[model samples]
Target: MAKLPTARIDKLLSSMGYGSRREMAALAKAGGIKLDGQALADVSDRIALNPDLPQRMRVAGKALDPLQGLVLMLNKPLGMTCSHKEEGALVYEVLPERWRRRDPMISTIGRLDKQTSGLLLMTDDGALLHRVISPKMHVTKSYLATLDRDLRGDEGAMFASGEMMLEGETKPLEPAVLEVISERQARLTVTEGRYHQVRRMFAAVGNHVTALHRESMGRLHLPEGLDPGQTKLLDADEIALIFA
Candidate 1:
């Protein structure tokens, strides 16, 4: 396991919704917080410098255990919705309770729709989510789409130039990269993620996307051996790929 870095005790706890740092400090002042079986004297006191060394912390008669902020790449299966609504099977239900409990806000990096599947990343880190999903960063997402018919005409050129008009959007979409993978399939690369974008792009060209499977986001690709509905924690190097 990788070592968890050190930070202020109250700040860490507050990030986990324990309370604000000042509030936690006041609680410490009231003798409600304990460290190693003694009343904590300083809110600034830091423990957990090493993930190997377990630190005992308690508040309001309950232990305060911090998660290491796990990032998981899930191979989303069909019939799942990433959101919490009951419109379909909740995607986070596929995660173990341990990961789902990181916070109520753990979310998929980008949505894969109810029927589209593959390469969904889930995490509790708000900073990581914003950095990866922000449109200004130009991070590329790649997908393999099965279409209703063979691609024809200057679809590739059209996608490359951002010449196609999507409905109800004021600005033309940023250019997409489309390639013919087979008679009924093609690979697409795009930076911006409008609603049902790959399907819409194909529809604009008079073809229909019958199936869509995202292959990669930035440098992170779904490993072939990973099966649908399975998840694996992303290592440090793999997490770095989100910003690449």
Candidate 2:
């Protein structure tokens, strides 16, 4: 059997956002780039991006064992927008250069406004993103809302009924869940990704939403102690949990 052709590590990873050639060279000089658990002495060396060949490439501490897929959950902070062309800082900026643009191109699974904060999902798998966030799938997104006053008038029943006529919608919602935690705090869960749905839902019932924080999407909850502006790659199980 013949060996596969190799790709320049710097070319492949730099295109994936590892860094500039000089920056990668610096990392190589500092002994940060590795191949198959061995420190690579040269950043420009060509190697097969083959996961099956037992030659993994690592930058900093992240191992790009398989160069085809990536999924990350970020604890998005307040005031930073989510977009490829937004005017301000982007959530994806927290990730390493390699995680930014590659063959498949990374993108957010869904989106959170600059004000909302919590578990934000990013991935290079287009099908997975669609499977999880598509309205037809009915995946539930949970939110912790701080309101101006107590929920009144059978709000829970109304949410469960899905008959509230929100503005610009031709019909009612697909039913939602609302649980009061206190006079001013509540947990709301909904399946649709309607623009400002949670805030508007409370407003429809005559309450004002003051603070909105997403808590979960599907079975994937933002892990405890994962602070704002921090991010971590999803473990295999954690990735599965998003669809579980």
Candidate 3:
């Protein structure tokens, strides 16, 4: 039997959603791509896709596609790290014993600092992760924050006026929705996710965030009645909202 014709290196990498044509070409030039039984010689080089090829393809010695992709949301409890650090409690630790046993190798779409909690998503779909995290997508994330003090009248205007500075940056934040929920709590909705942003923003205006909880991402709200450390699989529409 005749072997199938080879696919161009750039085409294969692009189909895998590694990058755009130009970017994939650069990666190929940097020796970042491989084909069955040989390193890709050029971005335009044609390489056959062997149906019998082993699942463990190498790119910079990193394993590819060892586990199926999974998308789920967890109500992350404080004190769990988002990373897979060996020394500390990672977010996966809070999953039911069955999920850990499956060893699906999921990762968070974005991180919630160890001190903040709620509406965290874990998945292995790199394409969707990239889309949602990319600034171009402009996905909105909402949070309910409990502060140490109340904002007096007209203080909420600062959110729209860009008076808040998140940590590790000198520039003010993009416009956001800030509404008082109570004397010591408020709802904040923003399109950008910066490090400790909620806390820093409150601090910039003479208030302190005592507790923070994310309520939604895009159109998907945290599952009703979900308690801390619990998780559930996301439905199709909910998944669509992440990219919407």
Which 10-residue span in candidate 1 carries the lowest summed lDDT?
47-56
Best by TM-score: 2
Local accuracy of candidate 2 as per-residue lDDT tens digits, 1-244: 7786777777776767667778878888888987778898776788875645324656787766345556888899988788988888898788766566566778888889888888899888898889988887888899999999887859999999968889778889989998889988999999998888999999988999888899998899998898998987776788887667
TM-score computed on alpha carbons, candidate 3: 0.67
> Across residues 35-63, which tens digit of lDDT does each residue of candidate 3 receive?
45455657787766664332435554443
In model 3, pairs of residues that clash are none
Cα lDDT of model 2 overall? 0.82
Question: CA lDDT of 207 in candidate 1?
Answer: 92
- Answer with 1 or 3, whichever has the higher TM-score: 1
| Window of ten residues with lowest summed lDDT in model 3 | 60-69
Give the candidates in order of lDDT, highest first: 2, 1, 3
Error of 3 at 230 (Å): 1.3
For model 1, how big is the CA root-mean-square deviation? 6.0
Off by over 4 Å in 1: 1-46, 49-68
Clashes of 3: 0
